[model samples]
Each structure stands twice: as C-alpha cells, then as structure tokens.
Target: MTTTAPAPAEAPASRVMAVPPAPAADAAAYFAARLAFHTDVADVHAALAAGAGDFAVVDSRSTGAWDQGRVPGAVHLPTAQIPRLARQFLDPAVPVVVYCWGPGCDGATRAALALARLGYRVKEMLGGIEYWIREGYAVETADGTRQLPPDPLTAPVGTDDCGC
Candidate 1:
C-alpha cells in the first residue's frame, strides 16, 4: 500500500511585516524627520571626539545619576532645571543633544521638549548614558573617566565602527 504524505503546515503570520512598508518618499520623509529629532550614541561620540564644537551634549538625568556616570564632557542639566538653568549652562545659539539614563528613560525627550520650547534646536540622544557605557565609550564619574568593554549584543567588538 502507498503511504500519503502529510499536508504542509501554514507559515505563522508576522506581526512585523503585517503592515506593508510606507511608500519610498513617505518613508524617506519619516526617517529624515526622525533623524532630525534624534542622534545615536556612536554619532554623538564621534562628533565629540572630533572636537566638533557646533553642538552641546546634555545629560538630563538627576544629580545622583549624573555623578554616578555620564557621557564624558556632557553638560549636567536635569529636566526639571531646564527652564530655570538651561541658558546659563548652554548657549542658545548652539544646537543641543540631550540624553538621560537609557533607552528606557523618557527624561531626554522631556529635556529636548523644554529646550525646543525655549528656542534651542535640540535632538534627543537615542540611547542615553547607558548606551554610551554599553558601547564602550568613556564616562565621567566622580572618581574619573572610565570605559567598559562594548556589549557584544549591542555593539561590535574589536572594531571602531558598528558598520551600520
């Protein structure tokens, strides 16, 4: 007797691609707008390392967090103090990049919003100090500057570039 083959199983529906991608022009505009409002840890580091003084990097976390560890050379301006102290700490003419604790934190966004309302061109650093540390960048602490090995999962090892 000949045996019949089992039927093929159906592929699972993907939540990721469930909706088709936007048209190219729309996607381009969307991404351009996003980039206009955000910068990543690596990009910020590169710019700072290059001695580009065109913009300022602001740490929007609490004092404790700021003292714990922060992006090297970052200005310590917490979200609550932005309104009262931003102008004193940062120049209104220079653009600003704000970051908080990490990707999970919304402190940077708040800081950026406050700065924008005050007429400063601002962009939120996408990953904050946590990502800076994770990406093996040196952080300024009370003791001094320290750097950790890049997390293999988040960044490439033994390489200067993420190859993005």
Candidate 2:
C-alpha cells in the first residue's frame, strides 16, 4: 500500500497582504538597508567560528546578565557605559555588533545608537543573547563555558546550516 501526505490546512486571509508588498526594486533597497543595520545570531556565530576579526561583538546587558551568560568573546559593555567607556574598550576602526537580553529588550538598539553617535559603525544583532542561547551556541559564564543542544524550535538539529 502507498501513502501520501495530507493536504495542508487552509490559512486565514492575511492582514499582512492588506498592504501589498513594495515593488521589487523598492523591496530590494529596503531589505539591503535592513541587512546593513542588523546581523542575526547565526551569522555572528559563523563569523566567530571562522575567526574573522573585522568586527567586534558587544554584550549590552547589565553585570548580572553578563555573569549569567554571554557570547563567548563578546565585550561586556553595558548600554549605559557606552558613552564613557566605549572609546576606551573598543577600537574605533572596527565595526561593532551589539546584542542585549533578547527580542523583548531594546538595550542593544540603544547601545548601537550610542556607538553610532560616537562615530563608530555599528549594527544591532537581531534576537540578542536570547536567540544566541536558543540556537545552542556556546555561552560563557563566571563558572566556565557550555553549549546546549540545539533547540529544535529555533535551530536545526544534526544539520550544518538552517537553509534560510
């Protein structure tokens, strides 16, 4: 006997399409600009794994959060300290990528704005440390470093890439 997959359930009419997508050229430009302003956790992990040194990753959360966990090599520069200590802690020549607690927190955005205003090129890391942890990347803590198994909801298990 042969079996076939069931048909997918019909989706509700989307409020998303209520406003039609922008024209292709406009969409391309918008998306490109967005990429310039944001970097995702996966891309950041790949860059770090490759030992790329062109940019700096910054954790913009507080001291307690830093103690809890952080990207392995991220600089512990809380958003409030970006003004006084940014130039001292970071090289002006390097591009900066900032991440905060998670999608719900705007600390990274505030840090990015502070860095940009100080004449440094910066992008906010989308999804922040929350996504970083959720993706099963190794995190550094006061105790040491540890990596969790990939969270199936956020990342592919037993695969090299997400195929996005």
Score every model by TM-score.
Answer: 0.90, 0.90
Score each candidate by Cα lDDT: 0.93, 0.94
lDDT of 1 by residue, 54-76 (tens): 99999999999999998888899
lDDT digits (tens) for residues 1-164 of candidate 2: 99999999988779988789999999999999999999999999999999999999999999999999999999999999999999999999999999998899989999999999999999999999999988999999989998888889999999859998
Write out the backbone clash pairs for model 1.
Answer: none
Each model's backbone clash number: 0, 0
- Among all windows of ten consecutive residues in candidate 1, which has the lowest summed lDDT? 11-20
Number of the top candidate by lDDT? 2
C-alpha displacement of 26 in model 1, angstroms? 0.4
Error of 2 at 101 (Å): 0.7
